[model samples]
Target chain A: MNYKASQMSQSKKPDADASRSKKIRQKRIGDQLRRLYDDVTNEPVPDEFLSLLEQADKSSKQK
Target chain B: MDDQAFKTELAELIPHLRAFARSLCGNATAADDLAQEAMLKAWKARASYQAGTNLKAWTFTILRNLFYSEKRRSWRRQQLDPEVAEATLVSNDNPSSAIELLSLRNALDELPEDQREALILVGAGGLSYEETAEICGCAIGTIKSRVSRARKAITEILESKMSGLTGNDSLSAADAFEDIMRQADELSRDLPADA
Candidate 1:
């Protein structure tokens, strides 16, 4: 699909102001997504998943 | 690979697996269910797992597949539930940061599944473009485009919501716009003059 070609063309066409705004927005979004990622990753693993893994290990040992 | 080593790797990957699952589903309960199911599936197929390959990618592939399959089933169930349909229109009344995060999550949930997956895999999961492409079964360019589009969509949605909130409330839209413009100005100033 020549995705890179199209993307490059789009970037080259945008003027400095437009491109600057786009970059700013992209950076802001990246920061927000990083925060969201941190929030999710820092959460403790639920006990059910730990119990489930133990069960799986025991059952696999029986096989 | 020894079973003990493999088990340790899997255990260490559980948090990331859950993070990916949560990013995919946006519901803690459903994410845990998906993660647990994927872990069980990975354990069952551990014999087929190659020694040196990326286990995280392999397990993520399994979880993504399971999520899609379950989504297909739940799509039908949601169609039959009036409450599920109604929930789409309900908005968070509180405009606190917590509510803003909820709105951000909702915006993410609204993105096309492929774009959301690409964005999360790269932005959150710390996977390389090549790794994400391998997991998604697409070219690296496609993954890049997906992530770019996802970022744009999320930013636009959040900006519109922010402007909307500022327009009617204590905060002024002009101030919000000025803040964004100031940020953009700083970014532009940091750029090289010629290019």
Candidate 2:
């Protein structure tokens, strides 16, 4: 990590400000990723998924 | 494991399987189809699975293998365009969160398949590096570097887009970062498993 977004800009912000802003940005991205994942995980496991499992179970026993 | 025990475990892991599939393909319908196929495959291969191992990791490996093989077979990079994918995956109820997720999803698309999968597995799928490396069929250090580079790349992409940085500076900066990544990759290839 270069730890400096300020390098790309002409603004003369201090290094500490640049570092803290980078950290905040990273934290936001991490949280956003976890939320994206959990949104799908939190969805109602479609009925087809449940029935498919049961169907497999029953057929295996019958065989 | 007994058939009953296997069924119990498989049922419990359904949501996770679906999530991993969705993240890989970015489509709800296709993801379910993939997840369902993996479940059946796992059931058929139940006898081969060692009992008391990491069942989630095993199933994840199965799902990921199915995803890639199917992808290779079809030769389709994307099942849905970005706009359609974003509209389908995110609800419009919360504008801010939707924007946040939509942008990341687009940024994630820019990464190579290896790095994208590596980042998803470690960063969001709640898997450890060893498990991720196993699932990805790569070195542990390779997974680390992919993830590290992915985070940096996404941050750079997102930040540049947000800050309205001058195109010339950002382009040059990106070129420099690419050079650094190539060097880092060469060095990481020989990194010890635990290093």
Candidate 3:
């Protein structure tokens, strides 16, 4: 959904410093979050999770 | 969906579920437990899942609900010190990335649970606001506000830390800070705004 902030900002004169700083902060945080997400996502799937899936598959077959 | 298709979709979503769980719980072990539990729950409820719907969001909703329920239970057992939780999550390998990640994690941990969840669902999980709002059980506007507040809070935290440091540390921090700020500034300028 389009954020109200983005919508409201469209109709008003932008405050240079405030908007600039806000954008910088948002981008920096986004970058860091992406790194964290990737780090976690890239980790190898553990053996236990594999076993759990196996068990699930077996159980579903029995059903 | 057929059971085979359901299983395939569920398998594909496990990595994302695990990653999001890790972000929420901040500990690898707990994250794994949460992910495992969520998978089991999803498997049990697979019949309810509609065909051609967003399986990832459905699993996320299950995982998030489990996390919150577990969080409530843990809170009753003992108060968890955020600093202690963070220390356990931070790794010593790759000093630079570790430090940056630690700070980012700390900042994320500082956010209210709703705001953090909203930010993670949208920013990190790459889910649309509509999906996040559905997962969060809130209006789309509320999700946006939560994300906005979360970003603002994280920026303040990192900015304060950057300002507090000196010499070489400050230089590196400033460099990263300025790089993002410049990009953001340019982006803002490119977007249409009333003169």
Candidate 4:
């Protein structure tokens, strides 16, 4: 009974460690994605595009 | 169409859409334009978008179609090879630390458009092969093949780049820290430095 308990404890420890490591990796990847988003969004929206979207919105409103 | 509802849905998707576009286009300016064009297309085709379906996948399909259409019609036929450009960028200072990361990005950049799109949809967008196939308007088997090819090509490129670095036995904990710092620096350009 004691041996079984020790064996169970050993398996449990690895699972816990794996979960912790997975969380860390998840957070790191999430942070990288967030950073990529920020970089992409911070750039100036092109003039032709801004004008095009404005025209698009106006056309929709007229309908 | 309910303007408020459309806006809310679009707001939620902008970041993911941008990431997908950027990954496809390999740069910021082109990606923003691609994403904006996609949103416009989505807005115009709002009636076709069935409720409860994948908005991100819909937007991705629009962007991919637009990108290919533009490429086909454009007069500037000679495009700069992204892999070669990436390779050129590798001769920067501190090659010891940043080489692996830069090479990986370069390998990704070097991928064929279809394979890159598949990898981004699966690896980055967290979409399954079925969803990716749907977005790309291809078969599930095709999507799987593209992703497999992309991973293999990228791994090959990265391994070749790292071969020399592996010989240097002095890659210590400090070197690892330097790599993290280098990545953080590159990442800072992509986000608010404070973030």
Which candidate ranks first by TM-score, i.e. highest? 2
Cα-based lDDT at residue B48, candidate 1: 92
- lDDT string, candidate 3, B1-195, tens digits: 887788888888888988898877776666788889999999889989888888898999998888777655432112234664455346435444455666777778778889888988889989999999888788999999998888878888877766655455446653465445544545565544642
Off by over 4 Å in 3: A1-25, B72-94, B166-195
* Model 2: CA > 4 A from native: A1-13, B72-93, B165-195
**Number of the top candidate by DockQ?**
3
Q: lDDT of candidate 4?
A: 0.65
Clash count of each predicted structure: 0, 0, 0, 1
| Candidate lDDT (C-alpha), each | 0.73, 0.79, 0.76, 0.65
* Residues B4-49 of candidate 4: C-alpha lDDT, one tens digit per residue: 5765686567767677777766655566667778888987888788
Tens-digit per-residue lDDT, B130-188, candidate 2: 99999999899999999999999999887666555344554555444533443354445
True contacts kept of each: 0.53, 0.76, 0.67, 0.16
* Ranking of candidates on lDDT, top first: 2, 3, 1, 4
What proportion of true contacts does candidate 4 retain?
Answer: 0.16
lDDT of 1 by residue, B14-61 (tens): 888888877776655566777888888888889999999999999998
Better of 1 and 3 by DockQ: 3
Give the lowest summed-lDDT range of ten residues in model 3 chain B: B72-81
Give the Å shift of residue B52 in candidate 1. Answer: 1.3
- Candidate order (TM-score): 2, 3, 1, 4
Model 3: iRMSD?
2.4
Model 4 CA deviation exceeding 4 Å by range:
A1-55, B72-100, B164-195
C-alpha lDDT (0 to 100) for residue B126 of candidate 2: 92
